[model samples]
Target: MAGASVKVAVRVRPFNSRETSKESKCIIQMSGNTTTIINPKAPKETKSFNFDYSYWSHTSVSQNYFKKDIKMK
Candidate 1:
């Protein structure tokens, strides 16, 4: 059998109640299979990475449902 590449993903969750109360902001964004993270203190300095999948679930229900269907080796 041929060697296969390992699949990877990035999951970004929104701030919870406590964070919201503190006025925290999200500096991450996902586009297709690419995820970009921006420095909160230095907005101009950003970094990006690519993954097989990206999940942006702001709620527990959505995140739990997505996790249930994922199969890991």
Candidate 2:
């Protein structure tokens, strides 16, 4: 059998009601294919990761996932 590569992606969702009630802020930011996560407790600390695709579901605008973006052999 031929070796296959797996594609990975990340999706961000809006805060829940409980989180919003606590006045929590979002610390996730996506730029191009990179996603950055900042530590809320430690503002100076941050971590970034890259993915094949990313979906942001926290906005009012509509988003669609295109099938052409994924290629299978």
Candidate 3:
């Protein structure tokens, strides 16, 4: 296991029916290799994490883009 590198990724999924019904806003955001999550109670409070990759699948358009991007890579 010496000299082995680890890769990690995070994805944001679309809201479910329950969440949609409650009109919940997405608190997660992804850009390049960074993923950020904002605190609902405090909009200014946000935490960002870096990974090998970051995916956005919270919408149909993003899902399609992700699929195409993966295939191209």
Candidate 4:
């Protein structure tokens, strides 16, 4: 690990069969190295977190995109 620190990378995936069938909604949003999660029960409530890396594979899955952003010391 870089800097001997724990690196957290959040990757959201496409809904699976069950979720698709149930029409589940995604409450997660990512921008830069920040991730915001919405409360399902309360729309007004949300929590944001910062991490070493955040991969938004849910929208676009490109190996090059991931490789380009991720770094190793």
lDDT of all the models against the reference?
A: 0.68, 0.69, 0.70, 0.68
lDDT of 4 by residue, 18-49 (tens): 99899898787766677788899998899989
lDDT: worst 10-residue window of model 4: 64-73
Between prediction 2 and prediction 4, the one with superior lDDT is 2
Best by lDDT: 3
- Give stretches of model 3 more than 4 Å off: 60-73
**Better model by TM-score, 2 or 3?**
3
Each candidate structure's TM-score, on Cα atoms with residue i matched to residue i, is 0.69, 0.72, 0.75, 0.70
Per-residue lDDT for 1-73 in model 3, tens only?
A: 9999998877777889999999998887666676678899998999989888766767754543233342112
Model 4's alpha-carbon lDDT is 0.68
Please write out the lDDT profile of model 2 over residues 1-73, one tens digit for every residue.
5898888888777889999899887787676667788898998898989888777765443333222232222
Q: Give candidate 3's TM-score.
A: 0.75
State how far residue 58 of model 3 sits from its true place (Å).
0.4
Q: Which stretches of candidate 4 lie over 4 Å from their true place?
A: 1-3, 60-73
Query: In model 3, where is the ten-residue run with the lowest total lDDT?
Result: 64-73
lDDT of each residue in 1-71, candidate 1, tens digit only? 59978998777767789999998877776666777788988999999898887786754534332334332
